[model samples]
Target: MEKTKDKRREKISVATEIDRLEERRARCQDNLERAEFRSRKEKLSEKERQELIDEMAIMNERVQQLDNELKMLRGENRRNMLLSVALLAISALFYYLFYFEEDL
Candidate 1:
């Protein structure tokens, strides 16, 4: 009688574990189905997605063009600054050569 009771207890424990595992499996499957449904519903049409991608590409190109323009402007500014410095130096040299004689 004790042996029979032990066997019944083991069977009950195994059945409970199986039921728990089955419930978990069902929940996981339910979640997967919900996710798949949401994915299908939330997806954009191909044409609309492509249009958005194209618009982003055009904006990126425009940004690159603006960067190039800014770089050219910076280079031009540097060149102008160097030219001004050179002109100032030449003016000082000429003034010293011609006007220093008068002072002396």
Candidate 2:
């Protein structure tokens, strides 16, 4: 029971963490888009343009990292679910095969 509860807690925390990462990813993407738009505008100093490019690059990198982390978390969640199911199946088999009374 405690293990199940802990798993539930972990699942909820992972979901919350993913939500935060997704929000950060969206913000980074929006910032990159805005920077791109600014770069496309009429005129800007070379330094300003370079700064915009740099900011976009950083944000892009952050978004990619968050995406990777999210994928890893999702994969972990799936593995945990599979493991739980397998354990439950094994316990059920044990209960039926070994724990049951034999009456002939």
Candidate 3:
């Protein structure tokens, strides 16, 4: 009877160890699957990053073009203003010389 009881206890211990090993194996498999999923997610398009860079460069170039256009327009406005002032001055001088001086 004692030998039989010892054998039963040994069998139960071996069974518990097997259960523990199975649980460990399941956990390791889950971890491996999770790692593979993460690796797949990481492997995406660097093209999006490059596209963003290209878009920024194009925007910068457009801004520079607008800035240059603004500067040219401002210079043109100044020249027009100077020409108007000079014409007004010449007209005033001609009026004085032809009419006002004769009346004096």
Q: Estimate each model's TM-score.
A: 0.52, 0.68, 0.52
Instruction: State residue 36's C-alpha deviation in candidate 1, in Å.
Output: 26
For model 3, where is the 10-residue window of minimal lDDT?
13-22
lDDT of 2 at 94: 83
- Candidate 1 versus the native: TM-score? 0.52
Q: For residues 17-81, could you state the per-residue lDDT of candidate 3 as single tens digits?
A: 44554555455455545545554566546875465446555645554554555566556657877
Candidate 1 local lDDT, 1-104, one digit each (tens): 99997787566643354455455545545554554455467676887656655655564555455455556655665787799899999999999999998888
Clashing pairs in 2: none
Mark the 10 consecutive residues where model 1 has the least summed lDDT. 13-22
Residue 15 local lDDT, model 3: 38
The sequence of per-residue lDDT tens digits that candidate 2 reaches over residues 4-47 is: 97787666766677777788888888888888888998488999
Q: How many backbone clashes does candidate 3 have?
A: 0
Score each candidate by Cα lDDT: 0.63, 0.83, 0.61
Instruction: Judging by lDDT against the true structure, name the best candidate.
Output: 2
